[model samples]
Every structure is written in structure tokens, then in C-alpha cells.
Target: MESIYWVLTWACHRRCRHCYEDRFRPYLRADLEAVVAEAERNAPLVLGNLPKRMTYRDPGGPDLPEKMGRVIISGGEALLEAVRERVTYPVIEGLVARYRDTGGVKVVLQTTGDLLTPAIVREVAQRGVWMISVAGIDDFHVGMEGEAKRPPSRRRSRQ
Candidate 1:
């Protein structure tokens, strides 16, 4: 397979009008070790098949295909307060440690951006996350209240 989409948890804070995860199987808790083991098992296979190196369209940029296919870690708000430390970070750390030396294995994080604090962002980036894709600013998602009235500024996490 070119990539793996690992849904780390089924727990989300929002009851979005358009989200279907709650309507489906609603087992919100994730099995951290199981998910990590599975990713560890499959990562080598995926990484092995990719080219060792490839030229990028932008010569000044990093290499392609060899550094491109994503192992996207997402969920019912993957970074939800409940499971961020318990499931999400462990999963990311495990996979990054497993594939740090392997080419073409970028660890990508997908979150709703609701609970992403500066500390969490830094922790993930330091742990080897190549990218963080936030899916928060949509009309369907009910906005937060009071202290969390606004999603954390993405710029705050910039290195």
C-alpha cells in the first residue's frame, strides 16, 4: 500500500451536525498498544516499496515519493483532551521511532484543532510529525464557548 490512514481514536468533543462517526459505531476509546503494533507491523512494508529517492518539482525543496507517502494519524478528533496523551502521542512517537531512518515514511497528524495548545503542537513537532492537518474551521462544527471560544491560532505553533 502507498499509505495507511490510522484512526487513533473515536473520541471527539464536538457533536457536529455533519459528522457521521457518532452515528456509526460509537466506541470512542482507542487501544493504544494495538494501534501502535499494527502501524509498526505495516510501516516497514509500505516504506520498503517506495523509491529510495526522487527529484522534487522544486529543486530547492526536499525529495519526493521517497519522502512523500503519508501515514495519516486521525480520528474522532485525534487530539481530543481525553486521548491526546494516552493514545495520540504514544502512537505518533512509536511510529516515528520505528521509521526515523526509513525513507518515504512521513508521520502526518490530522486533528479538529480544538484542543491543540502550543505545548501539544511543539511536542508533536519535536516527536517527528512532518505535518499537522487541521479540520476545524467548518460551518458544520459547533463552535466552542467561553475560554475556548476560538481555536488556537495556527501561527502560535510556528517554529
Candidate 2:
């Protein structure tokens, strides 16, 4: 099976030292229509070889198509506050709704949970999108040149 990864935004709240986007930058707004079209085109090729039709419940509590595609909405932390102008809750919600409405396209939102709010989570969660969440071991981020920088945290260490 093949996968389609789309970097919808490059803006982020945290200036992580390890982030390549922080240095190079990403400016293009993802053309969701084009992405969906591509997925539709590839669906025919993939449908014929599905291991088996997997049945799953949709947002509205209906069965999704046996042959479906997965669309991952990723970025420099999707819910980052710094890039609010480029991406917002409405923008994300609309994109997700459109994709889910198309049927059989599993939507996944990848985030670091920096700016994630309960309302945003509820909205997206009810739409049937899968979440790919991650957290760092510490507040430090390794720089592009291998230097590490740590952020000041209000939370106290256990030790």
C-alpha cells in the first residue's frame, strides 16, 4: 500500500531547534482539491488489490467504503499558534469535512498538542479523523547543526 503525505502548513508556535522548516520555511498553501483529485485517480489502482474490504463506522455512524484512501494533514505542528493567519480551526475543519464527505478517505491530523484546544479536538474527533500525537522527552530541541537549545518551562521537574 502507498501513502500520501501533504504538508499543509509550515508555520509553528515553538521554534524547535531540530525543525528544518524553521530554517528553510514552507509557504505554499496545500491545494486540497488537487490532493483529493489525485487520491481519486489512485483509488482505482489501489481498490483492485485491497487485502480485504475493511468495514468501519463513519462520523455519522455509517459504513465506509471497503476500499478507502488515507490522507494525512501534517505540518510544523498543525495547531501551532504562531501561524494562525495561515491556518485556523475553520480552515482545518472545512478541509477535514470536505475530505471525509468524499468517503473512504481516512483523514489524520498530526500535531504536537502545543495549541490544541478542547473545542478543536471535539470538532475534529467527531469528524472521524485519526489523530497522530507526539510529545518531546524534554523542552530542548537539537539545532540544525546539532547544537541543542532548551526552552524555559514553568512546570517544575520531579527531581
Candidate 3:
């Protein structure tokens, strides 16, 4: 099934050695109301905030009468500094909670998994939001963050 992806924020706690989205952050991010307003603005022109408009049988056909499948909430790291910078943990929880409360929208979270605390895990579980951890893929995208500086003591001896 198709999914609707949303980048909730650009703030992350880890300055990873391969982060491509490192430069696109604001010093301060939007609050929950702003995020909700933004979500409302781009929402499909249907009741219950459903994605019934994105389904299509043909490339340039009319709207289908089916649901759009799933809603994926992602970011630089949603549960980490993104929540810290923009809204509080509860606010994001509320956002996911909305999708959870919606009968048709299956909510999925794509995150780095470095900051999934037990409390956060419990919250996600309680809200029935599925999570996809992406912490183990840093090596393949090595150049995004460029060469990292190393201390002389820990540096490898050059031949």
C-alpha cells in the first residue's frame, strides 16, 4: 500500500558522521499549533483528515473512492532534539495519537532509534504507532557529513 510521508522536523540530537539533513535546521522550530496548522493546510479536502484523495488507478485519472494506506512520520530524529526543539514530547505524541485515533490512517514512525527510551516506547505502543528503526545504515552514506576530525593521539599512523 502507498504511504504519505511527513518530515516533522530537522533537529536531531546526534551529530552523526553521515547526516545529509544537518544543514537544514532552524535555530528554533515551530510549536504544536503551528505544526497542526501546517498539517491542516495541506490536508486532503475530505472529512476526518483521511488520505482518500491520493489513491489512483490511472496516472492522470479522477480521485478513487479508497483510502491512501498509511501515514509515516519521519524527521532528522523525531523523538530526540526535534521534539526538544519544536514541541514537547506530549505534543508529538498527540499528533501521532491523532493518526492512531483515526480508524483508517495507520501511523508509522521512521527514526534513528538512538533515543527510543522505555517511556517513549511505552507511549508509542499505547498509541499503537509502528516504528521503523534506521540506525544501522550510516556506513553506506559516508560522504554526507564529510571527513571527521580526529585527535592526534587516536589518529591512525600514516605510512
Write model 2 residue lDDT over 27-68, tens digit each, in one string: 334643343334334434443443232224445544543445
Best by lDDT: 1
| TM-score of candidate 3 against the unseen true structure | 0.50
- Candidate 1 residue-wise lDDT, 23-62, digit = tens: 3122333554444444445545654554443212334545
Candidate order, lDDT descending: 1, 3, 2
Model 2 lDDT-worst window of ten: 142-151
lDDT score at residue 142, model 1, on the 0-100 scale: 72
Question: Which residue pairs of candidate 2 clash?
Answer: none
- Model 3 residue 50 CA deviation (Å) reads 6.3
Off by over 4 Å in 2: 23-67, 81-103, 135-159
- The TM-score of candidate 1 is 0.62
TM-score of each: 0.62, 0.48, 0.50
lDDT for each residue of candidate 3 in 51-79, tens digit (9 for 90 to 100): 43333343554574454355666665666
Deviation in Å, model 3, residue 55 alpha carbon: 7.3
